[model samples]
Target: MAQRSVRASLARAFLYLVLLSLLSTGIAILTLASSLRDAEAVNIAGSLRMQSYRLGYDLQGDRARLNEHLTQYNQSLRSEALLNPGRFWVPKEVRERYNAINDAWADMEHHIRQGDIAWYHDNIAGYVAQIDLFVLALQHYAERKMMQVVATSVVGFIAIFTLVFFTLRRFRHQVVAPLNKLMLASKSIERGKFAHPPLDTDLPNEIGLLARTFTRMADELQRLYRSLEDKVQQKTLSLQEANRTLEVLYSCSQALNVGTIDRHCFTQILQLVRQQEKVDYIEMLVGENWLLCEGTQQESVPWQSAAITQQDDELGQLRWQASVGSPPMPLMQSVASMLGRGLYFNQAQKHYQQLLLMQERATIARELHDSLAQVLSYLRIQLTLLKRAVPEENEPAQRIIGDFSQALNDAYRQLRELLATFRLTLQQADLPAALQEMIAPLRQQTDTTILLDCRMPTQALDAQQQVHLLQIIREAVLNAIKHAGAQEISITCTTSSTGEHTAAILDNGKGIASLSEPEGHYGLNIMHERAAQLGGRLTISRPAEGGTLIAITFRSSSSDNNDEK
Candidate 1:
């Protein structure tokens, strides 16, 4: 027979299980039927012997009982229970004993009919003895038959037990063991182990197929992992190059903030890149003039140069020379791009000034659209409702008109505040003076006592940092005065000994309750943005003195202190 797979084997095993169950049932039934038949045969044989004795007694002394005894004896000899059908295997010795009993009965009956009392009485014992022999034979046969049944039952139980044990063992080896291995492999995989032990695949079974599939899948994973490793390496190199480009650009931008993006800025940029990165030679060329050519001592080797472009005009070129290693083409390009912007340094300053003007105007427009516009629209709706209520000079109509008028006046004041904010340029580059000027108006506008604490270094912040710091302060103070219903607002700008600067706007307002600004509020957001521009952390909290405290703390050019406000 061809080797069976797991499916066929499983089916065969199940069939065997069913067969064993049926065989066990059949054995039980056979045991019961055979035991019953054997017992019945023994019982019939014993009855035959008793009937013979009774018949003999009747013929010798009691003739009235003779008929009954004779009828029973004849019936037992011919009983289907004893002489069973053709299917029954009757012992030859048992048949001989039955024939002897029949022969003895026939002789005794002839004597009994002739009225020979002495002959009949003497020969009747022989007839009964033969019947007793037949009884003994049948009893032995029944005992033997019972023994056979016991042996068969024992054999069947042993066979079934063995079959079940082997079936379970086979299942464990073929299915359970393989599954356990797979589970172990899965656990190892979780721990980042990829290599797995090979399972048996020679068996043309489901487990074998699974093992083969797992092997293929594992191979595929290994291939994929190898491919990913190569890609990751390439990506890592690309990312490192990208980071270098960004660092170069950032250093260039920082240089531009202090110095114009001119010949001087390019020299600082090339020097900054030289300090951390590998470079043999870097030169800035403005019409063949080497503005910057600084790096390690020159080793004669490969050189690359990128054009420095400003808009559509090519102003100059940035050059690099390496003995063995040249920077990536992209990095060179990025550095060139950085140098290109610096080539038109004067124009960059004008562009920056233009951007600031545009930003200030945009901020004013945004504030109007977000705040004053909404209030005016609401007032317009109220005016429409008021006209509808014109006929009725009710108190509600008067209240509506009053609210409309109040909203209109508030909107006008907001528009004025917005205009005043956007008008002043922070060219003075003085934090204390700007804060004082900003607070002077707020102080005149409100009953709030504005205390100014100006203990900052004279040149701690640059021009733009000062401007952003002042704006952040103005925004904080404005919110406190307008929204928190503050009675006294104190502004503080202090530089600690550790060089950290703290700018705080504290007010005796409803503190925490006013901190959760309503949606569409831009003043708070603008304050945060300005603080971020100053490289400071902004905080708004309620101090124990019972009002909102908005503070910004940052590191100045001369200091290195962490944010704490």
Candidate 2:
């Protein structure tokens, strides 16, 4: 970008130089031509004046000679001597010589006729002197004009040369030099070195401004690079920490898979969690249901499970409560209820293990969805097309080829779709928009009526809170649709009194049977987890009518409070 800017600037500078040179040359040529023409005119005028002076002199001399001849004839010679062939008007050279000798001859003749020789001589001399002065003035004028013409030509040449030379020099220094520097800097930056600074020197006019701007741009780029480096370093540390946590989680999962359901297994899990440098405490409960606690203990409360009918004719409940607080009476009651459910169903332990695995897979699927599924879809399409282009060979060959291709495509598409579903569960947009879009697909796939009564505040929610609320609401609605077996479901969201937001999913279906049973639902667990992560609470209840209600509440942002204020 910098190089392009410099090139454009240089191009403009070159054009300006060309125009200036043309203008200067044009003016110089005009002045020089004018001077030469004036000089030629002066020279011609000087020559004409000199000739006129000589003619005047000759006319005077002729008149004087005529007078002298008349005088001599009267004194001695015969009258016919005046017209004698031998003495015809004197030879042209002699006449011209006599005229030169005596200018103003016509005036002299007029004076002689008036009998005023002294006055005629005086007027003749004065007139001759005036002609001489006029000739001298013309000569002086011509000489001066010639000198001026020469001087003008010289000056014009010098000006043209000076303009051309300076223009080219300035083009090279201000334009070409800066352009080359920009190009070199760009190339170096492209090769991973961004250290070059722009030239800071006295430049011609606009070029100086451009150079300063380029320098500022370089400084900004350097700052951006430094900021990016810092962010990358921080992200690297975060990823490392995440990886270590995953490793430990993996190890625990493997141990759970190998070990039997016993106190030792639970204790081992708790010990491993506590071993974490960042963790403060760990607790586990097992019975008809189970509740595990990790990190610092603030409070625990009794759990109540919403009753959900299973395909099997068994009446059981299983719930898991994980909290980061001291054991409270209500939480302990919730845990005791979950333990009662677990004790009734021995498979509860295995089910809990599966839930953990599902959570991990869900997380992994999300990552794959964001990074790899798109690529795999493209590959699957390419492979399918390639397979179609190939002809069916012998029976065995066709069978093997078909089976392999079908299996690979099926696996690819299933993995892609699974990842996509997990991503949808995690990602969110505007609450109203997301709810509308989610219902579109659910309405197409299921017979459940998903009614959204979302009365969000006048101001929109923050992105993080919006996403969290959307996920919670989605999970609640899906649970109602799948487990409650409801033909109609309603989700209503509204701002709470203390500037908190709340969403409720209500269904006119089966409700909680016993205080310990919770609809045998995994989504309930997910909703609870999401709510906890958002520093909120999730509640499930059976209304007086035969239906279930899932309500979630979380604190609104400070900005929302300010808006209310």
Candidate 3:
């Protein structure tokens, strides 16, 4: 069936009602107009009765105006209302009764004209009765027209009422109910749920189209809502990760900013990395030394490692055990790089301390060399002149003078060694460069080859340790130069896997005659003392090939020195 819109249905219903009302109006108008003519016919028929009585009174009394009464009666009987031929308002019974009155009046007229008063008296009542019957017929006709008017009015009202009732019902079902459902759906969407049942789309109306459109729009909205939720969740996770990265970086920076970095500090930084990256275990290794480690090692799981580098120098390795899709390499590497910088700063701080100590010792050495060395040299010269002046005459005085001079000479020599020891200075932070500088003057003094190989870790030695180690090496080299009288000195420094440092000074020189110190000479004793200050063992040995080797072995001050077995 063809679909009709609400507008068309309402308009059609209104048109039907209007047509019904018009039909009723038209019928009522026709009936009322006929009723008006019926009233006039009844009045005319009633006047005939009055005229019959008046004519009867004229016959009984003087018989004067009898022809006039008869003429009036005949005119009333043939009146337009009673005798009109084609008036549908006039009933057949009224017409028949009017014709009967006319027939009775025609006989009465003959008698009255021939002076027949007794005949007129007898027929007058019968003619009035016929006139009464005519009036009753006209009344019945008017009543019937009124009945038609009432019936048309009642039918029109009933049809219009039915149309209104059914139209309202359809509107409720097709328009109002669907619109309410749409409103409810809108409310459900507002609450972030698509909970409403499906709308009816099969109706052939605007409501059906609206329902289908609303359904599609709701589906699209639901999809968009889900998408938005996912996006929001993703953004939140991104923000959280960014916050964690920033926190790790900031904390690592704080840990590195201190004056000294130790195993404890590195452990803290690694812990921070573990917390941020959510790793199982993490550790830092500088060369073979594991400086700091956090969490237990799971050898079953392969570790993800990043080089801790600064300016292309790989300072260490950072290793951790994490899942396959762990945090990106850049973040872990960034943390590793930050730790590398911390190690660099630690080395630099140690160097700075060493430099300050060397500078202080040099200052003391300068003060002593300028004042005390001049006085000691002058005294020694004066004592020598006194000895020469008294030597030929008095043996006892000469002997005493010789003893004093020898004692003075020994004291002067010991003071000079002390000055040299105090004057030891490191011009740069690098140990290799400082060692080269130390050996430069010695190299110029002899044709012997002096090779220095330093391979110690940057953080292995502190200021005091470097000072003591340098003193020990210098003393050993000087003993080779002055006493051994040999050439070809090689100084090599290395670190073991257990973080132990070893420095060897070898020279193809005459071996020492005895391990004991010579009388009034304490070079070897002082060298041993310096080694003791480093908390190390100094060993002197003659190789089978006839070279003297002096080496010191000690653990690095920076490490726990636990060797992995």
State in Å the error of residue 550, model 3. 2.2
Please list the residue runs of candidate 2 whose C-alpha ends up more than 4 Å from where it truly belongs after superposition: 1-363, 366-421, 425-428, 458-460, 513-521
Tens digits of lDDT, candidate 1, 127-203: 76777788788787777767776777787778778888888899888888887777777676667677877677665
Candidate rank order under lDDT = 3, 1, 2
TM-scores for candidates 1 onward, in order: 0.35, 0.28, 0.54
Report the C-alpha lDDT of model 2 over 165-279, residue by residue, as the tens digit: 8767867876778778777877777676878765644564555666677777777887797789889999999888767666656555554554334333434554554564333
Per-candidate clash tally: 0, 33, 0
Give the Cα error of residue 38 in candidate 1, in Å: 3.1
In model 1, state the lDDT of residue 122. Answer: 71
Q: List per-prediction Cα lDDT, in the order shown.
A: 0.69, 0.55, 0.79
lDDT of 1: 0.69
Candidate achieving higher lDDT, 1 or 2:
1
Locate the minimum summed-lDDT window of 10 residues in model 1.
556-565
Compute the lDDT for candidate 3: 0.79
Poorest 10 consecutive residues by lDDT, candidate 2: 76-85
